[model samples]
Target: MPTAYRLLLPLGLALLSACAHQPGSLAVHQQSQCPLSLRSGQQVILTLPSNPTTGFRWVLRDGASSLLDSLGPEVYSNPEDAGLIGSAGQSTWRFQARQAGAGHLLLTYQRPWETEVAPAKTFDCPLRVQ
Candidate 1:
């Protein structure tokens, strides 16, 4: 093989090998991505539309604790460039696949004080880890 071809072949193979072995994080934005399939040690990121200024918040009812581990509490971020009060934002939660199992990651959006009332919105996603 030519000198340049020999050098390029190993570099290309190295990159392909790295990608094949790396477990990438899975991002879930809506219910359409339900029945998530993840590998052990892979990160799972869940983001949902939220507007906490309206007194509604997404509460974690089930986090698939047996199959995944929570990385941290929910994170809320608003678009600073919007420059408007009570603007809609997003809430994000992170988790890591722990073991081979299946469960549901469920959340309800509603006012915490109104226990008697039903949730305004619900997000329930089934998760499978291997």
Candidate 2:
């Protein structure tokens, strides 16, 4: 191989590595008609398996009310589902709510290296008393 090609090879490799797919995304479920369950308390309970990624952050909004905030590491290999991240970024609004009432909910997620925010999803629904 040419000496020039050898000298430039490592630089080329570095450039290629920099272009690797960034970590982070928001997904939602289509045709999902499941309801969100809310209980009378300050905590929301739900179950999910770990997603495959670096980390995740979540935000919960009640459309008409101030945001109910919760943030945590998004360990994709473990049970990492942000109740506020929504299913595939799709949300049922009333699921895992800490209050019983009528309200709209939106879930969003983002990671450290993400260039764009996950879809700003909004779900209008009634919080069913569980």
Candidate 3:
């Protein structure tokens, strides 16, 4: 084989090996339906639209801890034009698939202080961890 070809082949294989060990993340939005599948140790982010000024927030109705582990608490971010009043932002939750099993996540957007009213929005995700 040519010396140039030998040198390039080793470099290419090394780069691919490095990438294989890196962790991966998946992002799911409100429009996305449930029954999602993921490999073990992969991370998933659930993002939903929210406007806290109106007293509506996304709360986790149910979390299947046996199949997934919470990376941390949920996070919220506002749009770049934040000066506008009553503008909506994004709320995101991060979780890591821990084992091989089926699980579900339920979330609702509602006012915590109000009990009788129904949620303004909801996210229901059924998950399979492999």
Best candidate, lDDT-wise?
1
Model 3 C-alpha lDDT per residue in residues 26-115, reported as the tens digit of each score? 888865656789899899998888899899998898877998899999898888878787799999999999999997898989999997
Report residue 124 deviation for candidate 1 (angstroms). Answer: 0.5
User: Which TM-score value belongs to model 1?
Assistant: 0.83
Cα-based lDDT at residue 115, candidate 1: 99
lDDT of 1 by residue, 2-112 (tens): 999999999999999988987899999999999898999999999999999999999999999988899999999998997999999999999999999889999999999
In candidate 3, how many Å is residue 117 off? Answer: 1.7
- Write down the lDDT of every candidate, Cα atoms only: 0.95, 0.39, 0.88
* TM-score ranking, best first: 1, 3, 2
Candidate 1 Cα lDDT to native = 0.95
The true-structure Cα RMSD of candidate 1 reads 4.7
Decide which is better by lDDT, 2 or 3: 3
Candidate 1 vs 3: which has more TM-score: 1
Q: After superposition, how far is residue 60 of candidate 1 from its true place, in Å?
A: 0.1
lDDT of 2 by residue, 16-112 (tens): 8876633222232421533544444333322223222425444343432432223332222222474543333221222223344555444444453
For model 1, the superposed segments whose C-alpha errors exceed 4 Å read: 1-22
Two-way TM-score contest, 1 vs 2, winner: 1
User: On a 0 to 100 scale, what is the lDDT of residue 109 in model 2?
Assistant: 45
